[model samples]
Target: MIHFPEIQSEIQFLTKINEVELHILREDQIYPSISGNKFRKLKYNLEEFSKGNYDAILTFGGAYSNHISATAAAGKEFNTPTIGIIRGEELSEKIAENPTLSFAQKAGMKLKFISREQYRNKSNPEFLEKLKSEFGNIYILPEGGTNELAIKGCEEILNENTREFNYIACAVGTAGTISGIVKSSENQQIILGFPALKDSGFLSDEINRFTNRSNFKLIKDYHFGGYAKVNNELLEFINDFKRQFGVTLDAVYTGKMMFGIFQLIQNGFFPKGTKILAVHTGGIQGNEGMNRKLKHANKTTII
Candidate 1:
């Protein structure tokens, strides 16, 4: 049996924001690679994989996907060979330029590159069949690893320690994490999801597949132009947050969510004495790659 390590979740207070007392659920401190929602999302997936007699595990991700990095680390520790089908065919030859891909490769994940057109067909029967033919019989984990099992794992994110918060907030990606949060939350706790992407219309349906509750909301204004897109304001906020709170948030997810939380508090969105909890979904490793991109664009880097 594979022994998965336990992660410590703690609460940190942000003091005041328009008389609102903010708390942070430091999910990022879970582990270096398998941290935050990635660890929560994979907890049960790995167990299911181990139960089956699968030879290797295959998953999908982009050039800087936190999911890709975490899966590679999990495969390494669990002694399972892993394959990452990365988007953007051109990245196949430029692995060195990408920190996330380089880390995955070093962790022993075999890399495959396909065009964005083909990647869009990743769920098609024929496309999956082709992958099986090439990689052999393998356990397939979806991009972001957001299946039913993943939501089950994520449900564990909230526990007795978090029951005091009136509102729980998290950065949304594939919606699996927030869906689990919504299902596991108390009846009075309102869950707020800050999407890191532009078009999150599909998240409502995807989340509904696993949850029947309407206790959650998706805030879309904080995306900062879309996925992977950043600006000087975000960089300043991330660096300032690191200095002030001693937590480094990735520009893609956690940073954006925190920014939105602060904005809402300042705009008088929350009640005066509302107690809010924001989740820190870790993806700090990808910050190096993001910093490199910012440098290339001649913009300020995230510390």
Candidate 2:
């Protein structure tokens, strides 16, 4: 088995609102490159890869995908070759301008840029066969790296220390992280998922596929537009949050979840004396790319 660094996530108290206590589980500090849920999601997958005869690990992701960055970093750290099927063909020439893709390239990941239409068929068997023919002996990981092994890895995020909380909250992307949390959560602890995408009603079904538990709820109001979309309000909140708590949240996921959690607190969504533990599933590296976009658009950037 491949050895992994010990997880050092800590539950830190944030503040109390309306007699409700809010705490943050700092999974973001797990590892620099492979941070937060990405680290958990990739832990067992990399172990499985270590035991396999595959020549390279091939995965799919967008230009600013934290998965792509983390996978590239993991491949480099483990001395294994990696291939990244990037979503936009236009990004081929713009790699120098994009921080995430540039980091991936520097980490020794061979990037293959494809059109948006082609990217949509990334899971298609025919398309996968074409990739296999091109890159021999590749072990394929899904777009967000949310396979069964990934879920199993995520299950380790929650422990006895987390049991005291009345509610567990996390930023949901592929639903794999929340599913694992729900599986390991105490019976009375309600797991709240804040999706980073708009119209994420389908995430319920995705979470259900992994666990039969109905104690989880997807709070759909926090997406703040959709995946990778951010507004000035969200950016200000992220900046203010960092200034106040010294915790940096990525605009795409954690920032929105934290924003929603604060809103929910003010709205009396949680009963009095409720203890909420919000999991900080990290993707802070993407903030640089997001800030670049904000700079170009003349909008507020995350601090």
Candidate lDDT values, in order: 0.91, 0.93
Q: Which candidate number has the best TM-score?
A: 2
Model 2: residues with Cα > 4 Å off, grouped in runs: none
Best by lDDT: 2
- lDDT string for model 2 (128-230, tens) is 9999999998999999999999999899899988989999999999999999999889999999999999979889999999999999999999887788888
Instruction: Tell me the spans in candidate 1 whose CA falls farther than 4 Å from its real position.
Output: 6-8
Residues 157-239, candidate 1, lDDT per residue (tens digit)?
A: 89998999999999999999999999999999999999999988899898899999999889999999999888899999999
In terms of lDDT, model 1 sits at: 0.91
Q: What is the TM-score of each candidate against the true structure?
A: 0.98, 0.98
